[model samples]
Target: MKRWLPLSIIAATLAVAGCSKAPNGDTNTSTSSQVAKTTANEAYLALADDYFNHDLALNPISATYVGINDYNDQFGDQLTDKWLKQRHQLNKGFLAKAKKIDRSQLSQQLQLSYDMFVYNRNLDLVEETFPARMIPFNQFYSPLFSMAQLGSGGSFQPFETVEDYQNWLARLEGFISFLNRAEDRMREGIRSKVVLPRTLVERMIPQINAQLVQDPTESLFYAPIGQLPESFSDADKQRLTDAYQSFISEKLTPALLDLSVFLKDEYLPASRGSDGMWGLPNGKLWYQYLANRNTTTEMDVDDIHELGLSEVARILAEMDQVRQTVGFKGDMAAFFDYLSSDPQFFFDTPQQLIDGYMGLKDDINQVLPDYFDVMPKADYEVRAVEAFREKSAAGASYQSPAVDGSRPGIFYINTYNLRAQPKWGMTTLSLHEAAPGHHFQISIKQELTDIPQFQKFGGYTAFEEGWALYAEYLGVEMGLFEDPYQYFGKLSDEMLRAMRLVVDTGLHAKGWTREQAIQYMMDNSAMAETDITAEVERYMAIPGQALSYKVGQLKILELRAKAEQALGDKFDIKEFHSQVLLTGSLPMAVLEDKINYWIASKS
Candidate 1:
């Protein structure tokens, strides 16, 4: 999975509370004539810069992640009405201005940029229509989980300096307010019948309880103090340590306990019994919007549900070929069971699991030259998922590198259950989550020059996840999946995505229970029951996100095939990839336009 900074971060806070400078306006041009004479490129680029800087101010956490330290000390309250109103107005105002820009006067590249900017702003505006704020967080997308990670000293939150440590203490104050407001929102959700499913709430209680420690040092929030810089004098270190310990015990612990107790005693009981979004108010329409938003297309739930079924069948047939090649006896189900049960496929230790993925970096990097010309300058490392949230997290996920290159991209492999981390799945998992996949695509986007910061950082889930899935398939052409088991692993990983298409829509639109979704995955693929359950619950938590993988992968595959046939001997595989990647993550329709234009110019 490619981890996305939640869009909710941008939808919060007071008006520009940070160290960001105002946009350098055209101070010399005092008249309307000068403004009117501004070129489309100049106007559009200015708007892009305005949007990026303004967004960074509101979304301080995201600012840190993107390598901007100006807002590191701030945490805007996302759950408040004031924040929601500002976020809506921000998108609305930008969309209006973006629409007025004359596309005809812009160069080809700016035209693409203009279209993407409008699409994103329009989508952001549409997202505000749904009452998502009423149901603030879940086990998978909780801010609490995110904050804990930031506090752990391993994530984007820097602990290298005294200012950095002080920044966190200030951020912690805002986090307490966020938790209080989240409780208020959940209470509102209960009244509105927009609460999370009971299972999701049940999972969340434990995660929240994990934070309610008797000793402040035992808390994840205390991690930064342990790694305080050696340069600090003993007196300064003591002061900082005392400050952190007090914050964790007096403020953070009580806030966590309140939320945890509320969930177990009040909220969990009120959570809905049904599994899908169909149970929420205006849920059908809301899910339809998400499907369209996540996939960056007009695909409705029915279109996606049917597409998933067809893809699942097609991939199963391919899996059968691998089953036969491996000389596995009996039916496909038997083969799935064999693969799931076999002890040889399991990793012995968590370090070995991390090492397995780490080991693939060299061979995978060696093959990159043949298929891709544009590669990320920033390197990546594989690490085990943190103990707090790994049980509920995806099998693996990729975090993009910091833009300043201070931090490398992280490929987090979940080793909570050894059985879930099968040896055969390592190659395909690595290909999808790390190299030539998210790490390559996202880093290259961030590194691109002459583009707006929004273009570098903001991306369509369909395009990003789709490209990663496509990269997994590219492993075959790169000769990385030559082993029959590894090939099965490829198919198995693909099957998980294919099933997600069916399951995400099924759970959200088609009234499927959680159990039904889990059973469907187990029937189709050799994934462990535990893994399948985690995936199914994940779909329930965030409807329509899972659909991005297949929807995006298929679109890219279609465009590639079209180019291959159109150019014939002229088609360069490397160039096809470069064209797709160099432009950053685009809407699928825009991507089609781009590829079609490339083919036309070549012809």
Candidate 2:
């Protein structure tokens, strides 16, 4: 799921809107003094706090991710029509009250919050138009994998205290209950003619079945019992272990098996054969909305489609040049074959791969301070993506640290097929997933104390993913992409993002089949076919998401180019980095404003 997959994690943070209504309700009347501005800003922040606190109760998953433990035991049912109604009402309420605040009276920072809140709510209102909840459980982000990730020891679910153990017992009951409701909604989806792709349903079946074990002790839910805090008395340990065993064997297994049966016998036949959301009712508009929401820009599918074609051509040329410079015989395809089959380019074992990334970790930390003034206090570790979900996982992903720093941020490298994890790609991948990439951006966002709580945890994919892609390019400045193959790896990675613009839009908007998308990817890059298939299916499972990487990366590059051109020799690379990052993750438009403001002030 990496099990912290990109689409789900980004979606988790997306709901956290930046702005809110001010305290004591809102006043639209203009006031012309710094004192009035200060008063309003204070009021706005208070509302932001209230809005954040309110959401924690409404969405406990959001709370757990944000490190707010108040609702740790309550796994709220977010699948029901009732839940969406509550969320809709909440958004409308905030939208109404927030609009009454006079923007001219708010500080620039508060104005950013106000604008983002307003933008996000409008988008949420747009989302209400789509029937996404009808088919909520996908292989990429269903309740099944989400629960597996939580119970699987290394993630958000704390195992520190006896209460932590007990909290999960209660939590899984709600999670299991949701399983039936999820199936119920899928049935409703069938009635509404809203069904997931047949390919995606096939994937979901195994993920659900993965948790169905006859022995309770072997269950992931029972894992915490094995790691029970040492401080627990002998009696307490025995009792907790008994509780978990009974819960898993009796309550949990039946629920998992029930959902799996529904998916296999009832749901799979109803699933459609089409790849894109465009095939659904109102699907064309849904894809359009998803593109805007994910990219946080006004780009349509055609604009993104053409941009992908241009970038793919440019990257292919770069790859060709690398093939020649490396003195490899034959064409780019032959070189892709050579690079892929060469035993010298892969690890014999998983430990070697882990050791390789760990080595990069030390070297990167030594060089990072030279490029940027800001750094994350939270440390990160490299681990293989856990085995249960590794089959469908991305090559690498980063999970932000627990806000309290008990668990370090993780850079999960998928070591399932060491052959697929190419040696040359490691450096660029490391930078993107770890230091100066996701770890740097996400951990820094988590560490920022000056932003509103929603903005602190909130993110837009374009800003978050764009900064990471930009980080991948930073390897050139750090002197890491010196080897021609390593540089090719960078181009390959960039090409993948660029190809996303092509294949992703091509799949959903242009009617490219799965075979067609896979063929296009293979023709263009040296990526493993296994990796290519996983990636192609990922785009199928979650549409318009892959578009975010290229769209985001290009924007960041554009802004940086502008900053350098405007600031001229006055440009400080470190300052430019800090200015973009210091505001945390903003919508692309808001990010532009922040960077342009920096450029103007410096000029």
Candidate 3:
């Protein structure tokens, strides 16, 4: 899983200062036409820049993640009515201006930007109609979790200078404001009946309690103080340390405790008993909107449900083939049990797990060039997921490098439960979260000079996740999954995605309970009970997101198959990959159009 910030504007403004006027005060046809296109493109680019820059101001934490530090000390008040109105007006105004730009007169690239800008702004406008702001924070996606990661000092929040330290202190104050607002919003959710499941709210209690420490130095927020630069004067260091300790104990800790108490004493009792999105007001339409938004397609709920069922059946057969090859004599259920319990398949320690993923880096890097012509300049490294959030974190996930290359992409392997991180799953997991998967796709996009900041930094769930899932399948063709057990890992991971399609739709659309979704997963794959529960709750917390992996992978595969069949011997794997990646992330429809154009030109 790649950490995706919620803002979805992917546009760039190319400021072509001016178009040259015709000589002798007379217009030349070709020159005039060129000038018109340039003027139109620049005009649209300026509009895009306006939208992009304002969005960053509204999401300062996300701005920090993308390597922009202009608002590092601020956190936007996103759930307030004033904030919502400002956001709506921002989109509405930019969208109207964007539409006024004659897309036909812009160059092809700017036209793509124009279409995406309009689509995203329109989607934002539609999304605001739902009561999402009322239910702002959940166990899974929240500003709270982002702050925890940043405060740890190991993440993106810069602590390089005295100003950096002060920025974080100021940012902490803003974060506390967010917590207060979140409590207000969650209360609103309770009143409107747009609340989270009881199960998810239960998870939040422990998460919040973990932050309430009596000793400020023992807090995760105290990490930056310990890492103060050697260049700092003795007085400055002591002053900053005293300030941080006081802030943590006096301000931040109390805020966390208040939020935690609010959850236990009030919010939990009010949380919904029903697990799926259908339990909320107008939830059915909301889930459908999310389904379309996340997958970037107009796929109906029942169609997605059926597609999941079909994919599940198809992947199950492949798993059986792997089972037979491994000489397992028992039935699939027994095979799942044996695979789940076997000690040989599990990593002995967390360090070993980290080493196992790191070990694959060299082998994967060697084969990558055979399949991809373009590669990221910023490399990646494997690390254990921080203990604070590891319990709720995915089994493995990727964080893209900082835009300035100050940080390498991080492939976080959760070592909380070793059974969930099996030995056989290493290859497929590495391929998905690390090299030639997220790291490749995302880093390449950030490095792209031609696209706008939004396209470079923001992405659709389907396109980004879909590409990673497709990368896993690509590993098999690359001969990385040669061992039967490793091949089983591939099938296992694929089954997890295939099951997401069935389970996400089942939970949200069909009103499956949390237990039922867990059982569905347990019956289908050899995943640990811990992993199954976490994943199901993840879906409950953020409906329609789990559906992206398979929905996206299938589309990419379908496109590749079309390309392979059309071009035959003329097809080049490297070129096809470049075509998919070099444009940065795009909508499914736009991606297909681009591919079709490429195929036609090749033909």
- Best TM-score among the predictions, by candidate number: 3
Looking at model 1, residue 464 earns an lDDT score of: 96
Tens-place lDDT digits, model 3, residues 471-521: 999998999999989999998998899899899999998989999999999
User: After best superposition, candidate 2 residue 525: deviation in angstroms?
Assistant: 0.7
- lDDT measured at residue 230 in model 3 versus the true structure, 0 to 100: 97
- Pairs of residues clashing in candidate 2: none
Q: Would you list the clashing residue pairs of candidate 1?
A: none
Q: What is the lDDT of residue 413 in candidate 1?
A: 91
Q: Which parts of model 3 have CA positions greater than 4 angstroms off?
A: 1-27
lDDT, model 1, position 142: 85
Q: RMSD in Å for candidate 3, one decimal?
A: 4.6
TM-scores of all candidate predictions against the true structure: 0.93, 0.94, 0.95
Better of 1 and 2 by TM-score: 2
Q: Which residue segments of model 1 deviate by more than 4 Å? A: 1-38
What TM-score does prediction 3 earn? 0.95
